[model samples]
Target: MKSHSEMKEIATRLKRDIIQLTSANTGHPGGAIGAAEIVAELYFNRLKHDPSNPFWEDRDRFILSNGHICTVLYSAMARSGYFEVEELKTFRKVNSRLQGHPSRHDLPGIETASGPLGQGLSIANGIALSNKLRNNNSKVYCLVGDGELQEGQIWEAAMTSAHYQLDNLVLIINWNDIQIDGHVKDVMNIEPIADKFKSFGWNTIEIDGHNISEIQSALDTFEINNGSPTAIIARTVLGNGVSYMEHEAIWHGKAPSSEEAKQALEEIGTSTFESDLIY
Candidate 1:
């Protein structure tokens, strides 16, 4: 496993990749940027899989329930060596496999296709249930946006995971507090979030999403002996790595222009070959 400093460095590079890939003024940037560290931690240190063979049996599965921020996932997967990093520049281009949202048909590392909100949890529940019945010890990790909790289906899935005692399942909520419309609190509050998860029979923990060490420790709790699933509500910034976009709702789905992307790369303090060549 990479050290906290190594993971933090990878996080910065992924943030740079996120901005560069979305530079065509398409795709979601705010949430993607905010969730970069969490994604990096999973892909680089926690996830159990071979980029060389994404379908390796016994490999841990990762589901992007809130798929709008897939740019981060794509970046992580690429950097993790699932594919050439150059492919990131094709993101959101016409007929590109790297569409705005994940498509399992085209992407190799993605476990499932996700775009419509609120359905990912149910899908994850089914997968987890299948693994349990098969006596498979493999784990499943899911990333969901804070605003996505408004979906009634998500809670329904949560209840199902707990009812089955799916201890192998983990849900990490990107609690950036902002959705596409506005502040999550103003649009629809999901506050008392951790308490709500606990009430549903889940093991809940809260942590600073950007703190690498804290994230690693919180995730390691998955090894704890427990009968219920776990929920880690990561408190994050909406546009974490960039000054202009941070904490702003309007930037949720807006891509940066060339100049804006340049500024963002400068803000993140890292540069990739793709960063200078992005559309």
Candidate 2:
């Protein structure tokens, strides 16, 4: 486990990378920023994978249901040594391995190609069931957007996971309360998300998504849980860490200009990441 201070620094650096990468390619920045801390925590602390062997069988799996926010995942993968961080600059470019959404074919670390929401949970269910059959100790972690809960397939997967008692799977909901169009509540209400999961037989925990300690505690709780799938409702800001972008839908799919990127970087601070590569 990393020290608290080290985790904080990692989160900050990941946040910076998210901003820079999204700005460079004009991809999804809002959700990426919101998910930075949790992504950092998972990649840096909880996940088991060898960068040297990208296809290690014993490695844990991560599925991003809300694939639009893959900018954050790509940033984490780069920093975690799956690939050179310099590749982040090519995000969303034509023929780049890093597309607008994650594709398992192009990226070695990505487990699934997800963009059309609500399918990730089902995919996770399949992987979890396979792990159970193989008696594999590897855990499957899936990240879904709050807006994604509106999908009925998610409920079916939720029920399947519970029925199979896939304790090796962890479902993380990025509860930023904002989506592409507008506020999640305005677009579609998913209140009592925890109760819904509990009804489906999942062990649910809610926490401050941006808090490293809370995130760490949630992972520990998942480890202790048995005979049921785990769900973590991570409350986060829509555009976390960027003053001008927080809770604003405009930044959802918009990229920052060079000048705007400079200003945002100024606010995020550059005195952190071990690597000096910040585009």
Candidate 3:
């Protein structure tokens, strides 16, 4: 296990990578920025997976339901040794495995190809059920966006997971207020999200998504609570790390220019890449 400070530094470096890579490719940055800390915590501390053996049967699984935000997932995979960190710059480029959204066929760490909204939970349920039937102890984790909750399939999956008592499955909802169209409340409010999950019979917990320790604790707490699927409502800003992007829906699908990327990198602090002379 990495120390708390080491985890923080990894997250910071991944955030810097997200900003720089997205800016280079002009890809999604808002949701990616918001989810950096949570993803970092999971890959660096909570998850039990061997990057060298991507298909390890006993390994835990993670699915990115909100795939547009996968820039951070790709970054985490790279940092975790699933791929070369330098490949981050090829994001969204033609013939590159790292596309605008995640595809399991192309990427070793991605468990599902999930660009469409609201389907990841159902996929996670299937994986969890299979694990249970095989008497396996491996767990499944899925990350969903607040706006994606508007899809009816999410509620169906929620009901099914609880109905079958799939304790091996864990769902993390990125409850950032802003979505592409506008604020989630204005577009389609899923208020009292935690209560909704509770009503569905899920073991629910709410936490500051940016707090690494709290995020880690929530994952640990869920593991000890058996017989019910868990849901973590992680409250976070839309664009968390940058001054101009935080809480702003306009930045949802936009990328920073070269100058803006430089500023964002400075804000995130320097990394080993700075001295590598590889701009």
Candidate 3 lDDT, 1-279, residue by residue in tens: 777777778778778878877887877888888898899888988888999999999999998999999988988898888988778777899999998999999988789999899999999999999999999999999999999999999999999999999999999999998888999999988998999999999999999998988898999988985799999999998777688888889888999998888887777776542221135
Candidate 1 wrong stretches, greater than 4 Å: 271-279
**lDDT (CA) for every model shown?**
0.88, 0.88, 0.88
Clashing pairs in 2: none
What is the descending TM-score order?
Answer: 2, 3, 1
User: In model 3, what lDDT does residue 233 have?
Assistant: 95
Query: Per-residue lDDT of 114-161 in model 1, one digit per residue for the tens?
Result: 989998888888888888898888889999999999999999999998
TM-score of 1: 0.96
RMSD to the hidden true structure, all candidates: 1.7, 1.2, 1.6
Measured with C-alpha atoms, the lDDT of residue 259 in candidate 3 is 88
Model 1 residue 199 lDDT score: 96
Where does model 3 exceed 4 Å of error? 271-277
Residue 134 lDDT in model 3? 98
Q: What tens-digit string does per-residue lDDT give for candidate 2 at 1-279? A: 998888788877877887788777788888888898899888999998887788898888889999999988988898889999888888899889998999999989889999998999999999988988998889999999998999999999999999999999999999988877899899889988999999999999999998989999999999884899999999999778678988998888888888877777787776355664555
